[model samples]
Target: MKFLMSILLVGLSAVSCAQNRVSQTEFKKLMKDPSAQIVDVRTSKEVAEGKIAGSTNIDYFSASFIATAQKKLDKNKPVLVYCAAGGRSASAAKDLKKAGFKKVYDLEGGYDAWKE
Candidate 1:
């Protein structure tokens, strides 16, 4: 039972460690880099409100989310993703990882946080 518990903890840790989460400050720093691909995973309506400069909109709810991302994003380069409040970006980061993206950075508090 102890061994099983240990394995479970390790598995959970691995999953959490798979993606990097950054604060608004860290995300802003990353955005300054031209190589980093900034992706806004908010809905089109939300994006129309306002978004981080240089971020490309990719609706998380889109039917071709993954396919569109693959075509628009660089798999080898760093990717910075954010949503309205953070939840969607975290999920998007996981999908980005499974798609073979080397480095995935999720905005800690999403675009709302970025504004603050």
Candidate 2:
């Protein structure tokens, strides 16, 4: 049925995105490479609460996410994005890929997980 097919498509999309996420250890190793740009996609308020060091804040929910990301980074370079938890970062990673970023990564558990 069409409904079943739609569900299947959505499931597949989520799976593909999940496959793109990386663990905190992997993220830390990537940071050591220095070729990666780490991004925090949480809101200003969220950042005020606390954030991972070396991350640049560019709220994913903002109308200017695309513009801010463009200004803060080179579209061709590798970028790592994270939010308070994993949701927003995952969303941002998808957008970055659509925006022509060749290598984009999202923190699996986010800052909350990192802080622990």
Candidate 3:
């Protein structure tokens, strides 16, 4: 019984910590919220090409990724994250969730999809 209870608790915690993945449409709608913080988790070189307007670039590969996010973003505000593709942003979203951001949204297909 104790083992079963522990498993259930772990499952519940994982669900609570899961970050949301939003489609381009949903992402656009969410961005309309003035309080939302948009984050681009791409390398500096990649971001130099192009990026979402109003997004703050925080390299996911940087050792200070989470720390930089924690410093720049408001924990109380919703965060929308993207990368050149979906991969890095997905990881960033998870990290942001673990860092205790109240709401984290990952852009599906990332900046590529947004451009399309």
Candidate 4:
């Protein structure tokens, strides 16, 4: 019974910690919020080509990715993350949540989707 309860609690915690995945339209609307911190979790080279205006570049592949993000972002504010095509950002969002971010959002289909 105790083991079952523990498993249930763990499952509930996982569900609560899941990051929000937003479509381009929802992402755009959320971006309008002044307090939202937009992060591009792409390589520096990829970011150089183009990125959302006003977003901060924090390479997802960096060894200190989670630590850098924790230092750079405010825990209280909403964080909006994107990658080239939704892959890296999804991973980054999970890391952000594990690092104690209360509200983390991933851009579905990433920059490609937004550009379309």
lDDT per residue as tens, model 3, 1-116 = 99999999999977764538888989999999999999999999988989999999999999999999999999999999999889999889989888899899999998887887
Structural similarity to truth (TM-score) of each candidate: 0.87, 0.84, 0.86, 0.86
Which segments of model 3 are wrong by more than 4 Å? Answer: 6-19
Candidate 1: clashing pairs of residues: none
Query: Highest TM-score: which candidate?
Result: 1
User: What shift in Å separates residue 52 of candidate 2 from its native position after superposition?
Assistant: 1.1
On lDDT, who's better, 2 or 3? 3
Clash tally, candidates in order: 0, 0, 0, 0
Instruction: lDDT for model 4, please.
Output: 0.91
Task: For candidate 3, give the lDDT of residue 72.
Answer: 97
- What does candidate 1 score on TM? 0.87
Q: Summarize candidate 4's per-residue lDDT along 55-101 as a digit string, tens digits.
A: 99999999999989989999889999999999899889989988999
- The digit string of per-residue lDDT tens for model 1 on 4-110 reads 99999999988775548888878888888889999999999999999998899999999899999999999999999999999999899989889999989999988
Q: By the TM-score metric, which is better: model 1 or model 3?
A: 1
User: How close to the true structure is residue 83 of candidate 2, measured as C-alpha lDDT?
Assistant: 88
